[model samples]
Target: MKPVSLLLAVALGTATVVSAGPAVIECWFVEDAGGGRLSKKPSALLLRQSSESPPPRPDLDPERYLKVHDPAGTLLAAFRRYPRDAPAPRCEMSHYVPLPASAIWVSGLTPEQSCPRALDGRWLMVSMSSPVLSLSSLLRPQSEPQPEPALITVATAVLTVLTHTPTPRIRIGQDALLDLSFAYTPPTPKAATSLAPGPPPFGLEWRRQHLGKGHLMLAATPGLSGPMPAAREGAVAFAGWDDDEPLGPWTGNGTFWLPAVQPFQEGTYLATVHLPYLQGQTTLELAVQKPPKVTLTPAPLIWAAPGEAPPELLCLVSHFYPSEGLEVEWELWGGPEGRFQKAEGQRWLSALSHHSDGSVSLSAHLQPPPVTTGQHGARYACRVHHPSLPALGRSAEVTLQVAGLSGPSLEDGVGLFLSAFLLLGLINMLGWAAAYLATSEDSVEKVRHSTFLYFSLLILSPLPNSSPEGGCWLGGQNPDLEFTQTCIKSCHLKHAT
Candidate 1:
């Protein structure tokens, strides 16, 4: 038969193979397999009125061979031939025959021999009745069924997306499940497939041709990409601690009571968490989470004075939360160990004060002097007692000073006059020193001492609470011994000086 085509139109607008009749058909020539899905090929026939003649036929070239199973399942046709009445058998060989459009059927053309010779295309021309029909029939169209995406859809895409599943951040060491949903579907049910990259990868073999480009194609719309391009990175770090030592992974338990991480100690951890990557790059950041804040207050400072006496100056020193497995008991301290004492005739001090909540405090007074110290000084403080709180230990200390009395001469006589002269002279000296030093660049300026300083100096040093210098104490006396003699003379005179 000639290699020419007839009125073959693609009813579905697909680029169909050339056919021989006026029917616009999308066709496939399937080899009869014993069982399983029938696979088809791309070539089609363009039959003509001139092709009704009989001719020699050709044999199939499979490793194992059998004729196409008959449509009726009765007698299978081993091979096909062309009409001899048509143009001469092509290249001395043939795979199919053509019949006039008017013919209703064609015969199997049984041979005279039981074991007939195997057919080769070179022998003769043959004829057949065409099976192809017009395009307006039941054949499906070849157009894509998915949404007609704009070309700008590709350019404006900010992120790689899938129509079926949630947008997932690609991460290493993670398992990703993607749904196959983007496809051009027909009203009738059908299946399609795609193959991604390779380790041993998915390849394109359904159409019997290897892909020759950067990416392979599939029969679906809005395609998805394979793994991201970056190398897989796995890492981990310390989040924080609970008390003093670093905490473990369970640190974030109970809505994260403690910190989830530490100060970032060095170590490696593998987590299967989702993370975003730069486009076309496969990299996700694996960093530590900030640990929660776990703080604890130190135990309270509720203590009292020494001895069995409870301290008086006690208050709740403070409060704090206890760490795990530890319980706190607020207490009061009193008695001899706390320096508690009973006043000579007053009611006994409460051993400890109790709050309704079970917390306690001491109730003891530490007057100026102990019973042995004779109440002679003002080194006094209040103490507290608590059943569970600490014992007083010590009191806030005070310094005592015994003031020396002045003499009669200091009150109205020569000693007073002399002391006055000494103070005036000292003032004159300070003024002179200020005048002199104010103009000196290399020296620090002198500040005048207050009169109180002079008085304190006279009392503490000049007389030293015992000596009579500066006339603090007096007799009818000499300035040197005035302060000492003053009190003595006053007593003899019936009123203190």
Candidate 2:
């Protein structure tokens, strides 16, 4: 059987460059030889420059020509050679082949330009053809004619660039979704050309090889986690790709579930995507936040004397993340009508203190207005607001009571009664002394004087409202002062008779 030759020519170009950094170039190859017996002949070549004289073609020797490395197993696996007997055998291979600096020096390429730029129009040509027949040709008769080896070129491919756009800020423990977009110029006739005629170069196998290298990856500097392959389960999973046109812009949307981020995990991370011609990466910042613990001072209840100044209400917010955006609101409930309203008073906030664990604490003070009798049983509430808290925030409530407002209690009434009884007894003793002095002269005059003094004392002395008339008398009329009434009644009756 006659052996068929398959030639593939690929042109590589630099795609995405990071902050004036050097650009990287990648190449992939796919070949199909119509199920012909595979050959072990030198099958690949890399031409670095265009010379007036024909450039030398070297084999795809990893030690000399191309240093082939595929950290991602998908690349080499998609391009492995198949058995000769396999129907419609196809092979694919992709690699990151860096041109040696010595090669660039020998080519006299300027250092200012990247390797891909220096070898912009060069070609990576691969040939898959059976070996020449040496022993079989010798056995044939000298008269019989031998077919000449044909040099056929299959298809030509122009280089394409891949790029990733910058991602937005992500919150801790949030499900982050990244939209990855890539753009590349279409293949131009002048960019690449075929040397002969054969089969098409890029087909299903070529598409597989292209996709094998197009994987999104995430990594952190402080080692948040192991290298996370975006396509893996429980990590970043791509929904799908939008590539309507082969030569136009394309996009891949992926969802990454971030682990619960701690305070130490707050920082910038790198998201990268590898493609055939570019390694694109962008930075993603992770924000961490902790909810605040709220407490109000002078809690439960506050006692305000009638003529004294109102006490200060304090609200303490502690153990919160981010020192800013904290708010404290004061509310008052219970007036004559028992209506709830925002408390307007002198309000001030203390300077924020930052902790080593990245938490913040602060105190807010509210000086209430002068307390009044109407404000008794009023409740003061301190409500705290923060980004990490709920919309209504956390709150603490306290009740205010105005002293000297309610009339004297049972204890005060009892004390007043005892004091009044002692005063009345002292007045009676003085009256008896005066009567005794008068009685030294006449008994009738002394009795009359004593009755008059007792009546006078009763009229002049202030007393509690223990009787039906709301005042105590020198008779047994008030039930609360029965003992005093009984002792004074006999004296009162003698004086009346």
Question: What's the count of clashing pairs in each model shown?
Answer: 88, 1
Query: What digit string (tens of lDDT, one per residue) describes model 2 on residues 64-155?
Result: 22322221111122222222343321212322332422211112222234543422432332221111100000000112212222221222
Give the per-residue Cα lDDT of candidate 2 at 338.
Answer: 55
Q: Candidate 1: where is the Cα deviation over 4 Å?
A: 1-300, 304-452, 463-497
Off by over 4 Å in 2: 1-260, 263-270, 278-285, 336-338, 404-497
Which numbered prediction scores highest in lDDT against the true structure? 2
Candidate 2's TM-score reads: 0.35
Against the true structure, what is each candidate's TM-score?
A: 0.15, 0.35
Lowest-sum lDDT 10-residue window in model 1: 248-257
lDDT of 1 by residue, 418-467 (tens): 89899888865654443344333452222122232333334433432333
lDDT of each prediction vs. the true structure?
0.22, 0.44
